[model samples]
Target: MPESAHVTEEKTLSESNPFPDSIPERLRAQWNFLIEVDKLKTVLRQSPLAAVERRENDAEHSWHLALMVPVLAEYADEPIDIGRTIQLVVVHDLIEIYAGDTPLYDAEAGRDQEARERAAADRLFPLLPDDQATHFRELWDEFEQRRTPEARFAKAMDRLQPFLLNWMARGGTWQAPGVTADDVRRRKSVIGDASGALWEAASELIAEGERRGWMRPGQG
Candidate 1:
């Protein structure tokens, strides 16, 4: 072959198969990093806090709260940045993909949960480019602090969720766990600051559940 023809062929091959480091990010399978999150829902935590029949997996819990933002927005005491709150809920439980769900009462298990979750985030985020990862990490941290209006709403949604499940299902999960009326009341109390009306509703529902024997009586 002529020299010009040979060089042209070499250039074509280089374009087709660049070194891994030189490959365009658009060609990378980066967005697929969260695929592992699907497996998280099946990894059930050993907590009687919820029962199998009404047991919500981590993914369902995350997705439910993520989509529930609009329907439950009226409960918010003030206007919320709904878009940001939605994003926070979507990403909030992704770390459960690695760390598993820690229970509300299990302080011992929660001790290193932050570290484990951060490490998981590190592994998962790098699957995306640096900028995307940084944006997500910042949002996740803000959600944790509950400092922003959106974060406050996000936390409120989180609390409201299990309350709905436990109540709607007639304390379905808690029925077997022997979750007391006192426990239910205590859990719903913190939600008051974010939305007093919703807390009132949840509180009334808890009382009914106790009356119906789905939950224990409040301590005297």
Candidate 2:
């Protein structure tokens, strides 16, 4: 080829493949991934903060659940790897950054929720370097599947956190129309499977909410 044509081709290739080496490229990719996931702080869930000043964002919720893993692991029905459970909780809601938070009680909001969240996960997790991306995606998937001991305990914490927060807030979301004691029990059923102690504690809170007139009564 002519020198001018060869130069043009080289420039095109350089533009298309900016980071050729894996190490530095991986570092850059990881940094970009960190920055992108920080957007999780901006995606707020329906659950209010303990203080009830505002709804908790996805980042805060994940961090809280990760913290809970160590503190509450003793209550798990089966032995759990606390570190793995923390990892599961931390990445569990990263997909929410793209999909937004869906309220548990809103049947309409749940329509196609799995597809939306899976699409979000597909787009977001691959932003990291390949190895790290794959690992994080697996952690996220493990949490979602909820079959393993770590995942079950992690999911229990996920449910318990909001349950405690709402109870403390005098029925934060429970006061919303159409939310009843039966709905609360149904949503919280998994807690019993993970930790009977936690399940009993949550039951007490539900009972208190009922007695205090925070949760609707006589539905179930």
Candidate 3:
């Protein structure tokens, strides 16, 4: 037989038995969910990467937030379950893979943001097997609510990551028109609720940005 014929035969066999009967159904479902969620790497957010090469994608953002949880957990106003916080951050922005990232300062985009993300969550989470789908959906909801200490701390890191990036880049997003020091301050106020120490550090960064003329001055 020709080499081309042999290649076609192998492709057909693999397609017929993509997963061997030995693999459990639940494990296959989990694998499929993992593959589907990889699309998050293509969903770009408005925040610039620390290197300033381009906008950071949802996958990188989620990973960075997850890593920040341990390093910054001590700053949380109350004790938090670090494991839960890590899980929360990892899955928190997965919905953006479908709904798309909404820029923080775009008031026009803010109106329907929650509705759009909720719909995306509904469409995406069920890709997992039943139990995992429910668990992930609940974690995403908890992070959004910001009621628990873990959620609050997770939210703080979400805001703080971009804040640090912008400041490091000499006001990457802060340079956008109409983005005053007060605007940045107002947007990041939730960090204060999580930890006064973190809030003070953010305040110092903001002041430095303003002093360097990287941030626009607020109106008198």
* Alpha carbon lDDT of each predicted model: 0.68, 0.81, 0.83
Write down the lDDT that model 2 would get. 0.81
Give a tens-digit lDDT track for model 2, residues 25-81.
Answer: 778677667766766787767788887489888788888998999999999999999
Scanning candidate 2 in windows of ten residues, the lowest lDDT window is 1-10
Q: Which pairs in model 2 have colliding backbones?
A: none
Candidate 2 stretches greater than 4 Å from native: 1-23
Candidate 3: how many backbone clashes?
0
**Candidate 3 or 1, higher TM-score:** 3
- lDDT per residue, candidate 3, 1-220, as tens digits? 1111121121222244466667898887777677667677877777788775798887889999999999989888899999999999998888776677788887777788898789878887887899999999999999999989999999999999999889778898889877899999999999998889999999999988998999898663
Every model: Cα RMSD to truth: 12.4, 9.8, 8.4
Q: Compose the digit string of candidate 1's lDDT tens values, residues 149-168.
A: 78888888887787777666
Worst 10 residues of 3 by lDDT: 1-10
**What 10-residue stretch in candidate 1 is worst by lDDT?**
1-10
Clashes of each: 1, 0, 0
